[model samples]
Target: MEGRAFTHTRRALWETRTTFETAPYGSIAAAYFAMWLGLRGIKLSAVILHDLATALGAKAVARATQYFLQSLRPEVGSQPVHGWDSLIFLIIYSVIVFLPLWWLADLRWARGAVYRYRATTRTTKALHFCAEAYSRPPGKRTSQLRDLESGLRAAENAILRAHRYAGTFPRRSPRSAAVRAHAALVAGALRAESLKIDADPNATLPRLGAMLAVIGERCAEGRIGAMLSEEFLAEATPVSLTRTAIRESVHVIVVVTAAMVAAVGGSSALRALGVNDDLRPWLIAGCSVVAAIVVGGWHRVGRLLELMPGK
Candidate 1:
């Protein structure tokens, strides 16, 4: 009896399932997130490297200028060079660290949507094939059950391909709803057809044929494609464009700010500690690690909040 109950439950789930198949979103996100965090580390390292290189370069330039000045005027040799000369260099290094990393993050973020579109294309293709396959004569369809089921499975696979990624995005959308509805329609009809075949291996299911006819009519209407197209195009609207621009600008600002703070602040903190010049480079490296931790932790905290139950 227990076995029978389990079988019935399984059958019910198979027949009624409407949600997109689950993908490895959590695993993929975790992996990609590690890489994202590594980019922060790289940014920190860039700042450290920039400071060291500029220190050495500035020293050489200062020595050359000092010698040239002393040769021209013996008393001018003792004049001090402004320490803030490297400020502009630090800003330049910040831009160097910002652009490529920012581009990579944007690419990773956009990848989720790219996969979604691919999944939609595959599912739509499968749906169209199923509709065509169902249009066959009843006798021919008996020999085509395997093919029809294969098509349905393909559609399910396609939707699942990006399911996990889609979950990270906002829930409500016309395109997603339409796709879910179409999948449910197809899944229900196919499950019913299979049950009929199981009950009578050789008989044609008039009920299933009528259901398939309706499904074909629905597919013919092309409502799913229309809805998806509408939603996709809506992303290009002025408001959406402005929102995207603002979000991108925020990312750039955050990254550049972190880089500058880590570089300049690290040097100042070392100076305040009265560390000897020989230890300053080593201390700066240590400070970079600390800065990476603080900045990366802050970013990850925001991400965790975003992934929380609501907003």
Candidate 2:
């Protein structure tokens, strides 16, 4: 058992080392480092541009050597290509290209991810409906009173469920906050309507109705995802945002320019000193990781300028 365990561990280590040696580890490490720095508000644009330029160059080189790039020439395939061959082709094409692009661009895939982690679609719809209901919503006053009543009832049920599962949420959980807010709003609206009815038995209620409509509009159009609402977590860029961007842009330019020069000059110098091909890629990768860490950590010091507040 001990011998088998030792052999398995050694084999795993050897495989890992071999993969690193053959793969584009230098470019990968540099790319990740660039992303970390960018996210931390280091001159993000410059770092990104550098990575983009590198990718373009790499792609150009790759094209010369590789064949069968996801699909054939469009002009060559004028005839309708159908059956099992087309199905297999589409599966391979999607796996190689479409899936990565979808994830990177955060298309419909993000919505699924949002639902999986936070509140369900049913809960979100209930919150929105309740918010709109409380405001009475324009063109939907007494005409949709039944819908308003049903929405509020659904929201109340959702809030009760949320409270019951309070342990499932995070400290600053948006879904929980939204649920609580809607529950309070429902109670408040009911109380306000009751008081208005008691004070004036035959009140026309034009002002009260208008106010609710406006509030409902805000709630309906204010959110990006289930939890990120304008009222809850503001997405508007701050006044100081321009200044912060300029500073970071300058940082990126300086860092990226220096990195390019060093990479070119140092590589040639190291080659002259007889650095073997086997060791050179690892050295480059190490440098890329170090560069990313330093810039990322530098901005993480002192006060983190809230580039996008509450993001």
Q: Candidate 2 versus the native: TM-score? A: 0.28
lDDT of prediction 1: 0.45
**TM-score of each model, paired residue for residue:** 0.24, 0.28
Whole-model lDDT per candidate: 0.45, 0.39
Segments of candidate 2 deviating more than 4 angstroms? 1-64, 67-105, 108-238, 295-311
Give the per-residue lDDT of model 1 (tens digit) for 128-165. 55555456655666545665555544443443223333
**How many clashes does each candidate structure show, in the order listed?**
0, 2
CA shift of 264, model 2, Å: 1.8
Tens-place lDDT per residue, model 2, 71-110, is 2344535544333234333444444443433333223222
Model 2's C-alpha root-mean-square deviation from the true structure amounts to: 24.8
Give the range of the ten consecutive residues with the poorest summed lDDT in model 2.
109-118
